[model samples]
Target: MTIPALEQIHRHASVRHYTPEPVSDDLLERIVRAAQAASTSSNLQSWSVVAVRNEATRQHLAELCGGQRHVAAAPLFLAFCADRARLDRACQLAGLSQDASTLESFLVSALDAVIAAQNAALAAESLGLGICYIGGIRNRPLEVIDLLKLPAKVFPIVGMTIGWPARPLRQRPRLPLHSVLHHETYHPIRDEDLLAYDQTMRATGIYKDPEKGWLARSAQRVQNPERPHLAEAIRQQGFALK
Candidate 1:
């Protein structure tokens, strides 16, 4: 109760279901402005945000995102993109070659887009809104590109669903700081420590089955080498991350 930011930081949860109330244009502007204020590499600011309020577009996006109804149901949806098309065009107009389409450049733009989206999510939470990130956006990236009419050199990094929280919910637990952080030197990972952390996670009751621990679930997810078709999408979108 003492630290004001604690409520904003510690209580962050991904809200899947939402009410029918719509987000206002003024509120959306404030969130976007907050996102724009985030730092960018070399001030390139190679990022763009697409606010999808159209029901038709949202329906298509929902289908593209593995049929997650929230994509269309949320009061507002945002597609954060790593954009180099406009920048490349600008450089060309200035009689300069676009060396900015390199792998490093692409990474920087992607990072900028993620940072901006997170900023916007935090700002929305501060305004008493709830949000959930949609990594499923990348599952059918080419479909997203076609649906949104994104040009070459622009990639949809991620999508976000924003709306009022339906009701109060328990916060999701995170791994302990010691497990993830280090001091002066990196500490060796101990099998016992990892098992203990897994036990703690299982005890948190957030997992559907309390018997299933983090290690088993994570290993299963990684064991399948075949992820969603991203390479083809990326290639079709004109990003040769080769």
Candidate 2:
């Protein structure tokens, strides 16, 4: 079974170790062009990206990302941003407000940024480059804002480290499709399915603590509020998040 569309992302894994090879500017420009081709909500295109290559700046960014060494070591780092700055300018030009305070607007911008980032990641992978998406970039959003020197109404949703892999990628198995896909409206996963997945996790050695099941971890995660200050950070970036 050859899936042509998926060949670009086949067995994709986040590569932490990388060689010192530098990603060229021409290659980066081509990747960005592919990213720009991604569709946006109502064509609002409320997204932007900042490519960082300076070692010193990357060191600061790596610290902001909670000491992720890969951020600084990678040949290229990109910050995918939700940018309402352009929308604001458009509003000013039209003498109309886009009501950027709404939660819907915020979600749209964030989704747009994420969608574009995915496109860029795929493009990079197709070119034999490794990429690691750094969610820790949000650990200290305020600092990232200052380090990146982003204008008002612009914030990095995620950071990506891109370079040539130093070693082979470790491919992790994904959950079965039945657990996610539905036949009709909606359906809850059966308990037996979780138990089976737990066994699979243990057999696959994917987790350090294989005794801990995904269902249990998910239950605890939903209750535990991660990144409680994200709303305030988003607000500081000029989004209302209403």
Candidate 3:
């Protein structure tokens, strides 16, 4: 027998199409409590979520997120943020300043936000809702920060689109178990693994064929400095990359 949460995780899919129903405040609070339950580093939970329900704001955010229609269409759009503002406040209360300028500080806060978002997503899924993560918010980081009115020590890390699914859920194949799940020692991924997964993806008929497969596409994303302004934007958000 499958555990309830495990079953939910296994059936996870990014939902794009959504019905026109709004998520109730009660449901939102429940999912937020689930997010709070996520473990944080050193008990310093440096993350916050901004829930967007306003129409005009959601429209502007959708544009900022590279015109992802689901962001605008979803009943709720949640922006998960890497936030050290609370820590800064805590330090201020103790008459001390937060030295949260290191790269590690940014990493910890980003990871915390991501983990919390995953918990909230799972909770919403268990409650018969759908979700899609939007990494495109990084495309125009400065604009997003301005529009969201985030404090100096805060930055949007990810956005989640939530609503009831209007269409069938499409579950894409993940990398092979052995390719990702290594043994005691770190193992290098073999070329065959990529090819096999590429072949499996082609069978799905979801993604249009590119000139190259997964590895090539992955490399292209890395090679492209499309979000060149992101690092500077993060620095402007008070994370000193020095």
Candidate 4:
């Protein structure tokens, strides 16, 4: 049976255009509270969010985020960061040795940030606000870190833009259920499944050229090798990744 929450989840679409109206601080707090309610690893809650409302900062961030104008146009932009600095401080206060510099530490913090961001996104959507995740921020991690004044053990995981939608948005198509949901032991992806999904994507007309389907687009994206310096950047930010 379809519930209201399920309906909302299924209706989700990335909103690139937004109205000029600003999101009230009271409402933004509530949305963030909802995000804090998301499950965290070992209750560590190793994540932080920076709310960017300043016009100039947003404009600079938009430029850093691969020139996405929607980022600057949005009423609010949130930078979700994977943070272990707080935990390290806590450990030091207790006179204990802290070593949150490993790869596992980075992974856990990133996962926590991602989960919290999704919670915030859903909450915003429920309140009739539009939201878009900005992974493009990773393209210039060092710049973002400097702009935000992030600490040694904290790094940007992703960014989000939120505001009231200027117009209706069409839901994007997803991969077939069989391809994602595997039963028993891991099932190998069938070629037919990919071909069928590619055809479905072409039919949906999300792409301008129907000939350029999911497979081609996804392959092109991976082959482009964007953000090659990301790993080195993270290491410089104090993540051992070992």
Comparing 1 and 4 on lDDT, the stronger one: 4
lDDT (Cα atoms) of all candidates against the true structure? 0.87, 0.88, 0.91, 0.93
Candidates by lDDT, descending order: 4, 3, 2, 1
Ranking by TM-score: 4, 3, 1, 2
Predicted structure 1, TM vs. truth: 0.92
Once model 1 is optimally superposed onto the true structure by TM-score, how far is the C-alpha of residue 63 displaced, in angstroms? Answer: 1.7
lDDT of 3 by residue, 182-216 (tens): 89999999989889988777777776775566666
lDDT of 1: 0.87
Least well predicted 10-residue stretch by lDDT in candidate 3: 207-216
Per-residue alpha-carbon lDDT of candidate 4 for residues 10-127, written as tens digits (9 for 90 to 100): 8899999999999999989989999999999999999999999999999999999999999999999999999999998889899996787679999999999999999999999988
Clashes found in each candidate (C-alpha, N, C closer than 3 A):
0, 0, 0, 0
Poorly placed runs, candidate 2 (over 4 Å): 1-3, 208-223
Q: Residue-wise lDDT of candidate 2 within 128-163, one digit each (tens)?
A: 899999998899999999888999889889999999
Task: Compose the digit string of candidate 1's lDDT tens values, residues 164-201.
Answer: 88878567667777867899999877788788888988
The CA root-mean-square deviation of candidate 1, after full C-alpha superposition on the true structure, stands at: 2.1
In candidate 3, stretches whose alpha carbon ends up further than 4 angstroms from where it belongs are 1-3, 210-216
